[model samples]
Target: MVNGDPSRLAGQCAVVTGGSRGIGLAVARRLLADGAAVSLWARDQAVLEAASGQLAAGARVSCHCVDVSNPDEVSGAADQTRSRFGRVDILVNNAGILGPRAAVGDYPHEAFETVLAVNLTGTFNCCSAIVPEMVRNGYGRVVNVASVVGKDGNPFVSGYAASKAGQIALTKSLAKEVARSGVLVNAVTPSASETEIFGRLDDDRRQKLLANVPMGRFVEPGEIANLVAWLCSPECSFSTGAVFDISGGRASF
Candidate 1:
């Protein structure tokens, strides 16, 4: 749903991590339609290039292949983006990985570590890498993609919940630290969405997962993207450290 307003983000540049698919890709598309130059960052070179190519000619879009979990790679991607677009006005920390789910006592330590590394640490790494430039420019909008599980802890998905909870904390602290510097930091927590992340779950597990939602359905990626685009707009200046929810009717709070 591209807004009729085209100048909302005109001349701005945005970086969307994990933009190859799902919510990230939808966000990138929305931002581009709103007149922002967008760079899509992801781990797969083929997917990244293919997505970039799909954008219509003359669209302000580009692609970078990098692992958000690695600080050096995140920094490299930031460098490449700046090299191409000059400055990034917005950063969407959307790259994430959901590790294995199991009861606390049965869950492997490595699984927990991997989830934390990707979901929590990966968000931190990308933000850290890009904030310097954002600060120097005296303008920035950072949206960390968290989860509702981060707010109300979920069973079996303890590792993911914990990691996203950490992300919420990071978003709040970072927002406070940079509020005076013209950088607004916020987070979006989406409940179970209809995305490929559920591939890790068996049919029974997936069915059970959906039953817990009050809406009894998974959220659409585009719905999450619409919220994110607004948060990244100039109208979002006064807000910082806010955690916006897009969990359908399930997250009434």
Candidate 2:
């Protein structure tokens, strides 16, 4: 009904972490529109409720208040989703943090740890919970929302960049592990996008990040969702452990 042609994800259940806002929210919306039952996972209960209310689907939506960095929390959330829908067919690891916009030498050590904890370890936790189920079912799609900085480091954001780079590596490693089990694991490395995450950046830092994109613009959340939706579909077969660069011409080599 949403797409009108065919629902590639009909009868599927997708779990999207950080689904309360930004790219995660957009991906949740698209997956719903494409007819997948969606379980939105976020750290904020109120915000997650508000996000779920934005979608008009009846009985096909759920939300989990969870911190992906916590293994127990991720496990409970994933179990709840499986309980709600019988199985989780997809996972979008979109939760992340934008660490302090300071040079590596000046970056706070605690901030660096938090960034990696959330961006990389959190992703691992989510995958740890959902991927085993996917492998059991012999079908799955995992999209790790990495960044262009992960591909090529950005000045003044070493923590953010390094964390995302770990996600890229994680994606590849997981893909190889589950390749023959009908599961596809891949990454979407996007450039600066118009999202609340950008608000975390100071103007000087934001401008420097944007200036590197040859397209002269920030990528839209919906645009990233579009690519993600397809990647989650059956048509996206034959590709795993690959980087889908949505960096607007910024990711060179």
Candidate 3:
């Protein structure tokens, strides 16, 4: 667990996409603990509502059901959030979909497209929707959730790696464009993390992947969330286009 002053984000309002589970859920919890009002967006209504209820008990929290891959839905959700919370001070683009694992030559075309649509395009959609409001306020924090595969190529997940690499590039370009606007943009790259997303992998494949992590274990979801919560805090100023790694011993750079 990471420790810091609990009131660092007082009076701030944050929106976390994919906040119903995994890293997104953890980030929401941390932000609330730090005194920020939070809104969680997810595609599943029941799950989103339940998570929102749990977080609301700790802090001011709201939930919006949105499929990041759909622009209309995301836009609508943003409108609802702004109406409910006044304005969003931090936006965490954490929603992503991982495709099936297979050699590049044998990977399914539909799976690759699905991954790109949800991972890369979804992030773009959220950024486009939120940046304008952030610019108007002259202060905002944006953290994109990327992956180590984006830095060092992973053999079987070409689509996921490519989408995340695109997100890194997006982080850099947006950072420069919005630096003067007071909107700091950065990306977090974590190695294989232990989350419900990993449940999709077969036991044999999961073990093989885990064997390569120098730390001898999958990264915890909360570990990644800690970095994201800090980056979203006001304390994280004068830093943009930065790539932070929370990959244990898996990342050397």
Candidate 4:
């Protein structure tokens, strides 16, 4: 569905956090298809290898076992990616976790912290580690994969919603900071998508989420990947510190 010039990103290199599966994997495939060398970063080595095999782009794909929440690991991974590809021109902060589904009163404090650590702080870590180089080079594209629940808060997932909202805020703050540096920072807020994350939900909760999407269906990973490919492309100029909604009409603003 994402038909375009394959060479649009021929000379670029991209890093996708959580690139082993789900949205991150889809984004990696799309970027590779667009001719950008891709480095997949995830915590699971086995899954990362499987994803690398799926891409099947020898010499243009690398896998880094990284915990995005750990600054040292992120720094090391960034160095490895740069070593493999010479430079990183695009970053897709797609790593996140859906904390337990529970009311705020029942939510575990530790779980809340973990969610923020991964979804919000992890995004910060990657940007801090990689964006400075992009700044020096005067060219970059950063896309934070936030969620629609971030804008319109969802019940029973306070931690996840809060983390996503924080990511959106971070996207805007950083985008403005690099607005004139030829680097564009933006976020895509997708509604509930058809991904492994949904396996964590129960029948009733799943139905409730699906019903909230007026489209009456879950968004496809490829659909989200298509949008992300553009955001990471050279043509996505003039849009920085903005949030693009792919929420199936669920985003009111």
Candidate 5:
């Protein structure tokens, strides 16, 4: 349900990675409710199908199952989105993995690599493949999902934190690269949310994490989606290459 007008995004098309569930699904739902044709990209076809049904906007929503870490698959998906929708004006890079919690010296080597491959390199893959079209059109919005840990650094999840920090850096660099092209690139660093990602933390760690937040509550996906929807809209013009924190006052400086 759109809070204000349903035509806010009328005629636009958006691609949201990790759109099958969690914050990605919430953002897709908001974009569609605001009247943008949306393509949901994720690795699980079945989950994507379910998400489409949940959106209930019929042909206005499409689903493409692809791994964000794979450039070939991302290329094919971007091409297909253009073929089906004619353009992609907004892109939300929200796919990420939570690697096993451990000290930097003891973290699983493969797990760290996988996190970077999916969270950092994957964001680069999506932007590289899709932003060229935005450049050609002279209009676009890109919102990369980052994390507060990227800034302050959490104790146990070094890979996740490092990947998000890289994402923030990427947003700055890309925003500059495309600044003159009217393609605004920005990142959102959200605190722990009531999503699957938080489930990765054990009770003790989760409690400690919450203790760091002044709000003492997890963020809701819908709240993050609301911010993303605004960032995706033309109203967000004039802001680029910056980070918006939805961390419940946990971010300072």
Candidate 6:
């Protein structure tokens, strides 16, 4: 577990989609460190088991094999999570895919649909299944891991940009809906993090992406985790329907 004030998230439980690695895994580690019971949901059982082993948090953690793109699967996993942890106080919608890096006209139709299915619809399914519980509990925190492309509109990644844009819009709409219910919903846009997602990029594309960052380095998963942890905490009480940028000086506004 990471070093932090363990009592910050004491008695809380969180559900993190795509929690097997990268930003999702890092966020899980932070939440576990902050004393929250975490339920990790991912599509791969083998990867989930490995992540669970890495965490090694014992009873405070549980792994669920779930495809966020499937509403039925999401609902079932939500039920299991509630059964295991009693309640879910936080929901992190981090399950997403960087679709083909082709121009809009050249992008494959199937790939575009798949990206939207996993990134946009998946987020919707999770929120629909879990947010009601948060509403009933009178407390919740939802963080959507969006991307800079959503706001800035990067070229040759139309599908990814569109999906993340949908997430940001969804976050705002949901946050407004539950604003009076003590449940806060927000989005974080991180520019080009050095995750497995990078495997999709060629050297030229990678360099072009890096050149846009004034910081001259990729954003780290741990860095995004820190921001997400705060957003998931009681300390982030005033913000909702907001977008937090972890873009390493890449965001202009």
Best by the lDDT measure: 6
Global lDDT of each candidate: 0.87, 0.91, 0.88, 0.94, 0.94, 0.95
**C-alpha RMSD of each candidate structure in angstroms:** 1.8, 1.7, 1.8, 1.2, 1.2, 1.1
Candidate 5: clashing pairs of residues: none
Give the range where candidate 5 is weakest over 10 consecutive residues by summed lDDT: 1-10
lDDT of 3 by residue, 1-253 (tens): 4455668988888999999999999998888888888889999999998887766644388888898989999899889989988898999999997788799999999999889889999999999999989999999999999998888768888999999999999999999999999999999999887687767677887787776578777788888888998799887988899999877667656
Which stretches of candidate 5 lie above 4 Å from their native place? 2-4, 200-203
Question: Count of backbone clashes for each model?
Answer: 0, 0, 0, 0, 0, 0
**TM-score per candidate, chains pooled:** 0.93, 0.96, 0.94, 0.97, 0.97, 0.98
Tell how far residue 194 is off in model 6, in angstroms: 0.8
Candidate 2 per-residue C-alpha lDDT over 99-154 given as tens digits, one digit per residue, 9 for 90 to 100? 88898899999999999999999999999999998999999999999998999998
- Per-residue lDDT for 1-253 in model 5, tens only? 5463478899999999999999999999899888899999999999999999998989899899999999999999999999999999999999999898899899999999999999999999999999999999999999999999899898889999999999999999999999999999999999989787767667887798798889999898999999999999999999999999999999985
TM-score, predicted candidate 4 vs. hidden true structure? 0.97
Candidate 5 RMSD computed on C-alpha atoms after optimal superposition onto the true structure: 1.2
Error of 2 at 136 (Å): 1.0
Higher-lDDT candidate of 1 and 4: 4
Best of the two (1, 6) by TM-score: 6
Error of 1 at 124 (Å): 0.8
CA error at residue 135 for candidate 4, angstroms: 0.5
lDDT of candidate 1 over 88-168, digit per residue (tens) = 999999988877768999999988988898889999998899887889889999999999889877888888999999999
Report the C-alpha lDDT of model 4 over 15-84, residue by residue, as the tens digit.
Answer: 9998999999999989988999999999999999999998898999999999999999999999999988
Q: What does the lDDT read for residue 247 in candidate 3?
A: 73
Error of 5 at 167 (Å): 0.1
